[model samples]
Target: MHENEISQIVFDSGLKIHRNLGPGLLESAYEECLFYELSKTGLLIEKQKAMPLVYENVRLDIGYRLDLMVERKVIIDVKSCESLNDVHLAQVLTYLKLSGCRLGLLINFNTKLFKNGYKRILNGDVAL
Candidate 1:
């Protein structure tokens, strides 16, 4: 599926999860549940995947991990903060740049409504 189509599925799943369980839970809770939900849909998703960063010609393991990668194309960053900050956006964008991902979904599960927290980040710097 294209990133747009995959995003609809992921967005629906996130909405369902948020509806089933209100805010205030740990970010990890939402992550695992969302991961399970996504996995059940048969989408390719990697949870807590540790990916190395390469600079120039050296690969470094600096503990940067992707919260979830869907279809190995879109990067999903799960969060439960009161609201998403610049750091969240930067983090996901950085992931997309480093991983060569074209799209990213920054899903924050701390708002009363899922629509209030969904963000689609595109890696315009890297040609898709």
Candidate 2:
């Protein structure tokens, strides 16, 4: 599927998870709910997917694990922190780069409004 289509699926899944669970939950809680929601929508999803990191032709497996990957087109990172910072965006961007995905969603479940916590990050430097 296209990136936009996969993004919409992720967005809708987040809305459903937030609607049912509200806020203040841990990142793992949101991840579980989101996984179920996405699966119910018939989208192929992967959770806690380990992505190996390559540096100088050596594979580093310890520093990589994607929170969620939807339809193999988007990376989804779940966070339940009090607020999101640049570090959060950067982390998602790094995940996008490592996963070779052009689009990513950084969703913080600790906010009062889910919309305020959802961020769409695109890898401008990488060819999608």
Candidate 3:
């Protein structure tokens, strides 16, 4: 499937998780719940995926992990913070770049409405 299609599936799954779980939960709770929802939708999802950072031709086990990778095409970062901030959006973009994925979703499960907390980030100059 195309990246856009994968993104839509992830978004829908996130919405379901948000609707069911509502707000005021730890990020890990939302992460696991979203992962479960995505799996129910028949999409291959990976959680807490180990990501490596290469430096000087040497791979370092820096303990970096992706919150969620959907279909291995889009990255999803789950957040249960009080509010979505610039750092959160930037972090998602950085993850997309590092993972070589074209798109990412920053889903903050701290708002009353899910729409207000979902932000899409695309790689490089690409627009989503």
Supply the TM-score for candidate 2: 0.92
- The global Cα lDDT (0 to 1) of model 3 is 0.87
Best by lDDT: 1
Per-residue lDDT of candidate 2, residues 8-105 (tens digit): 87887788788888998878989999888888878789989999888899989985889999888899999999889999999888887887789998
- For residues 1-128, could you state the per-residue lDDT of candidate 3 as single tens digits? 88888878877877888888799999999998888888887878899999887779998888889999988899999899888889988888878877899998888999999989888888889865
User: Root-mean-square deviation of each candidate, in angstroms?
Assistant: 1.5, 1.7, 1.3
Identify the runs in model 2 with alpha carbons over 4 angstroms from their true place. Answer: 125-128
Candidate 1 or 3, higher lDDT? 1
Query: Can you tell me which runs of candidate 1 are displaced by over 4 Å?
Result: 125-128
Q: Where does candidate 1 have its weakest 10-residue lDDT segment?
A: 119-128
Better of 2 and 3 by TM-score: 3
Q: Compared with the true structure, what per-residue lDDT tens digits does model 1 show for residues 30-127?
A: 99998999999998999998878999889999999999999999899999998899999999989988898899999999998889999999997554
Q: Distance (Å) between predicted and true CA of 72, model 3?
A: 1.2
Per-candidate TM-scores read 0.95, 0.92, 0.93
Prediction 3 TM-score vs. true: 0.93
Against the reference, the lDDT scores of all candidates come to 0.91, 0.86, 0.87
Report how far off residue 69 is in candidate 2 (Å): 0.4
